[model samples]
Target chain A: MPRHELLTGNEAVAHAVAMAKADVIGIYPITPQTTIIEEICNLAANKTFSPKIVHVESEHSAMATIIGAAFTGVRTFTATSSQGLALMHELLHWAAGGRLPIVLANVNRAMAPGWSIWTDQNDSLSQRDTGWMQFYCESAQEVLDTIFLAYRVSEQVLIPSMVVLDAFVLSHTSEPVEIPDNETINKFLPNFTPSFKLDIDNPCSFGALLRPQFYQEVRHKLNDAMSEALIKINESDKLWKQLTGREWGIVTEYRADDADYLFVTSATTASTAKPVIDKLRKEGLKIGLIKIRVFRPFPFEQVKKYLTKCKRAIIFDRNISYGHHGIFAQEIKSALYGVKNSPEILCYTGGLGGKDITPQLIEETIIKGTKTKLNGSLFEWI
Target chain B: MPIKSYEVRFHGRGGQGVVIVSKIIGYAAFLNKSYIQCFPEFGVERRGAPVKAFLRISNQQIFIRSSIEKPDCIVVLDPMLLSQHDTLAGASSDCLLIINSRTADLQIQKSFNNICVVNASDIAVQNGLGTATTPIVNTAIAGAFAQATEIIQMKHLEKAILKYSPAKIQENVKAAYQAYNTVSKPIPLK
Candidate 1:
């Protein structure tokens, strides 16, 4: 029988890493993401697990350490948020380009200007082109499951993966998590067999500087590998469901079928949308929610299939793309640009800087966006 | 079912380690093979800003994901939070209320069958642990909690502290015992 326990999203990540038997964990303390490292360190100290816990000085060092460990065929893990993740941006690309399958838990916090520690998707969204697979988890249980599955997807496709959760929203919130038994998790995620390793004995060169002539082809190959990763993501999700009896696809559709309007979001925002959707459904609103679980390699085909049927769609983003609009909104619009009968998509941005997006706000935005017909760009900032 | 679950909420500021205190309680229960869950809630508030932590422990699984609207026990790390927010909003008549306050004359409007008032800060200071922070009060509060309901034994709390705490094991254990003696039960409002 599956054992059910209550765990915070951050603690769930720690538990997941322990279950995966990650050889090394490189982490630094940052808001929301801090408890994850703290718990992992505590676990290591208590001898609950024997993973080598390295307390790096900064998020940059944390990312670099994980990259180095992953290259040497060690299943490594790390975590960060907002400014922390932003600091690790350069190494994030390096980890991906080198095809090192590292798993990171990014507790999503808003990027600063006014200094916000609240939940937002901007940090991870900004690194969309970094070639790392990103999974935005909606609950504590999802956080656990996604971390386990991240290793599978990354190791199989040789692409690093990040499991993103809201800063304090999901990160600190404890919920009932049915933790899969060790044997079950072990069966689902086999010991990470490296596709390639830096062997000093064999004298193989890794990440040698590429000249301009060969750089494009190398970049092209990396992009092609990412495309191939999309298939592995689906396979991993399927395998996870079979083992754990929990169904999680790249994009989770909630009442999207036969709907006139759609709301797109990720992470804890999906939970916030549930009550709003429930209220709207009672008022005869044919609206639905589409949660983007997997943000990287952008599930364009699946998004197109569901979104193309809706008459109007509103992209609700917790993260802003500066002068333009919501990052996810922009990406969704780009995905549907060539599709026939694409929904009239609108962008609604709020909940930045830790501001709460209540059910009333969601309901009001949907009603306003659906009622109005704008000229030129359909995107409007809420 | 026979009996459902018990929910306890802790109120304090950001730096006071409210979440960690609740986690200790939850972890102790979990170690005893009880179903347990604990979490913290904070806004844009920085250090010293008011924060809250919630815990639910039961014999069976707990499904409620929302905040503890009706808490069986309310543990207040700071007495000021009681006046600043509705810390006792959904407390039942039988609900046990524990507060770490300096004001001896402070009173609750609603008459609860069980309540505990302790000057945990004073106890902590007397014990040579600087500041009446969450760590000092947490063990004391846990002791008071154990005394009030006996939900978790004093030995279980001591075991948990010894297990998780590395340096301040002896001081924390002393504080827990001190709290068990000092905390006053809820008295009916005249």
Candidate 2:
């Protein structure tokens, strides 16, 4: 039986990781993201969780250690934020190219040049082409549930996955999460064993220098796996939903049917935009919200199919693409290209450095999207 | 049925545990059948620097993830913070103001809203909960909020504070009672 536990998003992820029985857990403490590793450390110290908890000197070492462990073909987990994730840039690609199904929970924070510990998407969005599967969660429950889902999909496809959520918005905020029993999780996700491993009996060279021809084939294989993982994502979501009676698909609809205006958002902003959508709808406007939960595989086809109903669309992004438009807005435009009757897309960026994205701001964004003159500017920062 | 949502903001300095105060209030509200969210606001966390923590409670889950700009109530944990006089800048028109000072009545000018006061620092010190120099008034104010605004019950605040306090649970509980007993009736300024 499931029980409702009031937990922060960090605690929920830690709980999920514990239930998943990750073979290795490596972490370094970073603000907002620290409490998560702290919870995991406490669990390990108390013997509730048995994974080797490594308190590495730095975030880079944390990722490096996980890479070596994941290459052995065991379930592995790590958590980081902002500069910590940035420090793992080299290994992020390595984990993907090495075909290691490593699951990372990245609490997204604004990158430092100005040195801020606030929530933002730039940290993860900046790594858009890292070839890792990405899932942006909106609530604590979703944050917890995505861990199992990310691991399942990653392990099945042999691709790394990043479960991203806003720093304080979801990370520190507490909410009631239905925690599924360990037996149920074990049944859903059995102990992970890699299809191929670094075993002495079946010794094989890994991550060696490759010519362009061989490298292209390796890259192609990664793409094929990522494409296949989309189906696995849907499969995992369905399986979890069937077992736990809770489900979050790649794209969650918010009263979007029979509506022509849509708010395309991810993470906490999607939830904030929802009530505004409802309020507008109550006032006889047909505005709707479409939460893109899974960002890695892009869900381009689904985005196109669902977006066909929109007369206008607003892509609310927390990340600013310097000298250009909001990152998600840019991605949506790319996704909607050549599709007939695609909505008129507008991008609005705010909530940088942990600024609040109130329902009022969301409503204003909707109104702006509906009435903008569209003088060819990429986006306007609110 | 519609869910009513209320926002509470805390103004204080660092090291006073205002952040945890917000969390305790949130936990209490959650246990009381209200969906709760709380977070701290500051550019850099330094001791003696002004810091703010916010809380929101609704019968349904709150979707807005932002700082409480227009709070229904504002609780000031440090009486010294009143000297700058920018405490209740964005409070709602019909706000409830709770302060942690014996002389708060003299400080607040006449306003249409209600003003309630309790010497929370004295309560904390009287109950031997905080040090003499850095008196901790957060837990006391959590109790004061319950008494002054009736947004939360006494039992719920006690349940949350004692459960979450690192040490001196008994002392904190006593301080809570001290504030609960001492908070003045809301001065309704006509």
Candidate 3:
């Protein structure tokens, strides 16, 4: 029997971690993401879940602790946001290169020049080169399912996975979610099996500095693993859907068939676009939405297959790259570079600092982007 | 399509955990086999900033994705948030407005057709809870909500509370019962 529960996106992540039977959690509280650790602590206190809760001094220490825990062959997890994620930047690279399958929930918040605690995609997007597989969720239910899938994908590919949700917009927002049955989840995800561990009997060097000859090889191996991860991620997602009856893959397409115009976005922004898509479809507009659930590994093949055939596209990003344009938009446009008959991609940056992106705004932006005659100058604030 | 959804909005400050109040309500409805959705809207104000959380409950899947523009019920967790903006916007003429305030002025009383006032902070403090942050008001409000419409049974709320809450469940039950009895019905202004 399915159980319905009202849970914030943060709480949903914590619940999924508990369901995954994580052995150790190294967490430090940060805004928007703080409730995740709080819920975990409360669960620990109530003996609802028996995971070890290690309170660290800072996000840096939190990441280090998870790394150590993962190295010791234990299922490990943590949550952080914005500056906290920035603090864990170095360890993020370490976790990936060390090949520890640690799972992290990053509540996306804007970086500070003005000390803001609102939602944005920059915090996680800025870490695009860190080698961590990223999944951006569209709803609380997706947050729960993605975290469970993250563990499977990370362990299978030996790459750390970060599940990103908008800070206050999704993290603090509550929604009705179907908490999967324990047996179903268990049947879907078996007990985690670490590929390598630090054992006293079998002593091996980890993170050792290499000479130039070996350094290139080590990086090549990391790049190979990233390439392999793309396949593993899709495979795991496919298996997960078969087991749980929830579909989550590299990207989710909404009414893309016969679509002349496409609007691309991720996270909660995708949820905001659904109603607008329905309204536009009724008004005889051949429009559609493409939600990019997986950020790392780019999903370029799928993007080209699904969106390149459209007449035009609009890339709406909640994060900016300062001097240029939306980070993901720039990346998507680059992915299609030199491809013949590729859709004209326009970029719109909105929802920064937690601004609400209503359905009206999404409709207006799509209508304007599809009709605009300008090429690169279609960037407008909604 | 049948329209059977009930939307409730709660207004409060950032530190007050007003969002949790809506979650509890939605959970209780879920326990009764209803579909529900709850979410919070917050500004940049850190500690003392005003915040709002909205809830929608029905027997079928809810399709509305926007905030509660027209609320059937409005709960004011902090009376101070009421002073900042017009709380009556999108409020139905027959809406039940519950405010956590000490004042009983006629002007405030005349703002709505159905009003209920309770000093939930006082009850929370009296119960030895440190701050009225989130107050014991959620429980009281839950009781009043039940009494107002009887959409959910008292037993359903009890089960939901036991499942979700760990501390001060007994006190909360007491607060709920107290509020059920003390809340006065809205009277027309003279």
Candidate 4:
């Protein structure tokens, strides 16, 4: 039987890593993400988990350690936030390019200059082109369940995955979680038996420099693998649901099918929009919410399908693309390009550096979006 | 009718177990098969800084992952906080204020329609839960909250205290029970 217990998002991630039977975990402590490392270490000390916990000096070394461990055909894990994630930028590409299937939990936090420890999408969204699969979770249960699904999909496509949740908002908030037993997890995820590994017996050089003759081809193949991962990801989600009776779609639609207006967002912001949307609907407003769960291997078809019937879309983005509009707004516009009679999209960007996205604010956004002249401008700030 | 959702805010100093008390309430709600979320306002870490925590309980799965701006109930673990912060800023007239003071302040008494008071510091000291100077009043306050609100069962609250209390579980549990027994009726505003 699955055990029901209260756990923070970070603690849930640690539990998932342990249940996944990861052979190694790389750690460098940072606020909002420190509890994950602490819980993992505690689980190890209690003898309930037996992974080799590698305490590295920096996030770069943490990613490096995991990459090295994954090369040995072992399941590996690591976690970081904000600056720590920024420091691991180079190795993030290395892990994905090497096709290591290592899983990382990035507590999404705002980048620093003035200093902050709050929930924002800037950290993970900044790594958009890193080639790793990204899953933005709204709750602690999703944080736990997504890790298993990430590993399942990554191993099949030989791509790395990042499971993301909001800093402090989800990381520090305790929620009731149903922990899947080890036997059930073992059945769902087998040991990592990669066809390629850093074995002395075989003695093959991994990540060797490719000549100009073959570099582009290798890049094309990686892109093809990502396309293949889209299929594999859905398949993995279905399989997980069959086993655990829970599934978070690549793009989740909430009462969006026949709505005239839609609120599209990701992570905790998406969650915050739910009650607001419900209240608006009660007022007889044809408004709904679309939560973008999987950012990388972007669910283009699902997004397009949801937006087809809506008259307008109010996109709330926590991270702005600086010079450009909100990244999701940019992506959605790109997705809907050339489609006949697509909804006008109004992108409102704010909530950076852990500012609250309250229900009142959401309701106000809806009211403002309704009042705006159609196609006047696509970008605004809350 | 049962509450579809209830948002709660806890006001106290950093070292007085404000966060833990919210978690205990969350756990109690969870034990009843209700969805709950508990978190603290992110702040600079210190021993005596004014801090706040929040708890949300709902029969439905909670999807709003944001701070409670308009709380249905406010739990003040420190009476001193009432003078310093707008602890009742967003609370409605009918919103319940459960405080740890021996007596409600004159302004506070005039401010709310419903207020519940308990000498949680005295209860904690009597039970040896914390030092006399800085008594850990969270558990006692939580107990008073349970008594005043009648939202959480005393049995479930006891179980949560046992599971989440950092140290001296027996003392904490005793303090909670004593406060539950001695908490004042919901006094109307003067």
Candidate 5:
């Protein structure tokens, strides 16, 4: 029987990893992400979980250790946040390029020059091209569920996955989560048995240097694998829903059916935007919200499907690309390029450094967006 | 009818178990079969440094995941934080204020209409929850919170304290009940 427990987002991740029966976990402690490993240690100390917990000196080594462990045909996991994530950038590509099916929980903290430990998307968004699929979660339950879904998809597609939650908003937030039973979890995720791995008896070279003769083809095959990952993710999501009676869509469309104005955002901001949309709707505003759950796959088709008929789309991005637009805004603009009668998109950047995104602030942004004229520039700082 | 929700912000020094207070309340609400979300204000915390934690309890699922801006109730584990001006910045006029002070100051009584003062620090010391220099008032304050707000009952809070209190479980529960019985009734603004 499924049992409910009051767990913080970090605790939920630890529970999921333990329940998944991961063979190894490599972790380097960082703010917001530290409690995850700490909880795992507690579970291990209680003799309830028995995975080999590697206490690495740095985030770079943590990712590298997990990659090596996963190559031995075993389930592996790790977690980090902000500066810790930046330190793992090189190995992020290494893990993906080496095709290791490792799952990482990234607590989204602001990248610091002034030294902030608050929530933001820039840290994770900076790793956009690392070839790892990313899912931004809205709640502790979603964070826990996405870990399982990520593992299922990553193992099937032979790619790594990163599950993101806001630093304090969800990472430290405690909420009730219905933990799936061992019987159901085992049914959903059997032991990881990779077709190709570092086997002593089969002695085959892995990640050897390749000349220009077939390097492009290797990259092409990786690209094709990403495409296959999309299908696998959907299939995994359906199976998880069937097993658990819950499903978080790749991109959740909230009351977007007949609205002319749509609000586009991700993570906790999307959670806050819903009530604002509801309040506006009560006052006769035809506005809706679209939460981008899966950021890696981009969900281009799903995004276009929802915004094609709307008159305008307002995007709130908690991250800014210094010389360019907000990362999500840029991806959305590209996703809507050349689409027939697409909504006029406006991007507003705010909530960086973990600033509060209150319902009033969201309403103010909507009111400002409704009055703005597109003068060849569609960006503003809220 | 829409489900009712209550947002609470807790103010205390770092070693006072400020974050744990919010968790205790969340656990109590969970035991009552209500939904809850609790989180601390992320920062570099040190002993004696002021810290804040937040909680939201609702009869239905809470979709919004943001810091509490205008809290419906405020719990002050340290009386000194009340001296800081911003402690009650976003609270509404009718907001419930529960402070861990041995005696209610006139200034606080003049400023807030709904205020309750409890000697949680003294009670905690008597119960041996922490040393006198840094008495852990979280459990005691939680008990006062239950008596004042009625958001949760004494029975649920006792169970939560027993389940979550780190050490001296019976002492902590005794501290909570003592505070619950001894906490001063709310005094209207003068």
Candidate 6:
């Protein structure tokens, strides 16, 4: 039986990482995300776990160190937040291009212009093109479950993965978590016996300079692998449900059957939107909610499958893309383009830098979605 | 329908172990086999500045992640923060206010009929739990909260404090016990 414990999302991730028996963890402390690595360090010191804790000075070095460990066929882990993640931009491409299967926990914080360390998706959303498989978690249990799911998918596909959660909302928040014991986790995730590695017995060039012809082919193979990863996520999710008693796939649907208008959200906002939807429904409104669980490999099929019936869809993006629009809303619009009688996508970008997206604001946004729900690139400051 | 979840908020300065108060309550609830969730007021917390933390304890699972708009009980670790911030706003008329002070403010006692006052800082100081100038009142406040609202027991609070404390375990336990004994019973609303 899975034991129930009160754990912060950070602590949950740490517990999962420890259960996975990662070989190396090179972490640099930053707000919100700092506690994840700190908890891991404490667990390593107090428990029987013995992952090599690489004390790195900067996030760049942390990413770089993980790259070295992963290259040598070790399951590696690392964590960071906004500016810390931003500092590792160049190395992010390296891990992806090399297909390291490294897992990172990104506590999503607002990017620094006015210098705020609050909840927002801008940090991770900005790296959507970085080729790492991304999974957005709604709660502490989800954070714990998704780490193994991410590792399972990433290892099979041989690509890096990121598990993103809101800054203070999930990262700092404590919740009831169903902690699966190590023996159960071990059965699900075996040791990282790499198929290919850096060894004297098998010498081969790694990350060498290549021409466009070979590079294009490698990129195509990576693209094909992403489609396979979607299949892997579905399979692993089922197996996880069998092992534990809970599972969330690429996306989860709630009350969309009789809804005229639907609200789309991710991370903690999706959790908040649920109560609002229930309240509005009690008041005799036909509204529903769809939470995006997996963002990378985009999950367009799941999004379209759940949302095709609605008259309008409201995509809530906590981070702005500056001149372009909301990051998530832009993706939702693109996903719905070229479809016949598609639901309108109302783009609302609020809660940046940890601004509260109250249940009242969500109810109001549903009303606003009814008005602007008629499509196009709308950059609502809300 | 009966109450599904109980919302509790804590108001204190940054360095007063305000955030830990939520963890202690949640841990106790978890030990008692009830579902509990907690979080602090999202901010770049600085010492001596006002900070707030929230906790939700329920018999069933709690799924809401939003800020508690109307808290069922409010614990004021730094009683001065009651006026510095609207800690009492949006609370029910009969909502409980647990203050860490030598005596309950008459106005607050009148405004909130269900109120309890415990000299948490003095208890902490007497037990040498904090510096002479800055008395860390988190454990003491937890004890006061236990008596005023019965959310967590004093024994559980003391155990949690000691479990997390690297040094001065007895002192913290003493501070909490003192507050638990000294805190006035909550005065029910008329």
Top model by DockQ, which number?
Answer: 5
Candidate 4 structure quality by residue, lDDT tens digits, B1-190? 1234799999999899989999998898888888898998876657898889999999888877778878989998888778764787878888988888866544563367888889999899999988899999989998898889888888999999999997899999898889889876688865
Assess candidate 2 and give its lDDT.
0.85
Model 1 reproduces a share of the real contacts of 0.23
The Cα local distance difference test for each model comes to 0.81, 0.85, 0.81, 0.89, 0.89, 0.85
The lowest-lDDT stretch of 10 consecutive residues in candidate 2 chain A is A370-379
Docking class of 5: medium
lDDT of 1 by residue, A59-104 (tens): 9999999888888899999999999999999999999999998999
Could you estimate the TM-score for every candidate? 0.80, 0.95, 0.88, 0.97, 0.97, 0.95
lDDT of 5 by residue, A1-382 (tens): 9999899999999999999888899989999799999999999889877999998899999999998988889999999999999999999998999888899999999998889999999999999999999999998999999999999888988889999999888898899999999998888887889998899999988889999998888878778888888788888889889999999988888889999999999998988888888888999999999999999877888889998979999999999999887999999999999999888999999999999888889999999998898866489999
Candidate 2's C-alpha runs over 4 A off are: A375-378, B1-4, B109-112
Cα lDDT tens digits, model 6, A1-382, are 5787778899999999988888899988999898999899999998758999999899999999999999999999999999999999999999999989999999999898889888898889889898899999999999999999888888889999999999988988988888988777987887777788888799977899989879999988888888888999999999999899788878887888888888888988888787778888888889988888888888887777777889788888888887877877777877877876678677888988888888788888888877663435555878
- Fraction of true interface contacts that also occur in model 4: 0.87
Candidate that would win on lDDT = 5
- Model 1 RMSD in angstroms: 5.1
C-alpha lDDT of residue A145 in model 4: 95
> What's the DockQ of model 6?
0.60
Tell me the TM-score that candidate 1 gets on chain A alone.
0.97
Segments of candidate 5 deviating more than 4 angstroms: B1-4
Error of 1 at A207 (Å): 1.6
DockQ each: 0.21, 0.55, 0.39, 0.65, 0.69, 0.60
Regions of model 3 farther than 4 Å from truth: B1-5, B12-17, B43-51, B58-70, B77-82, B90-96, B99-105, B108-136, B149-151, B161-171, B174-190
| Model 3 residue A55 lDDT score | 87
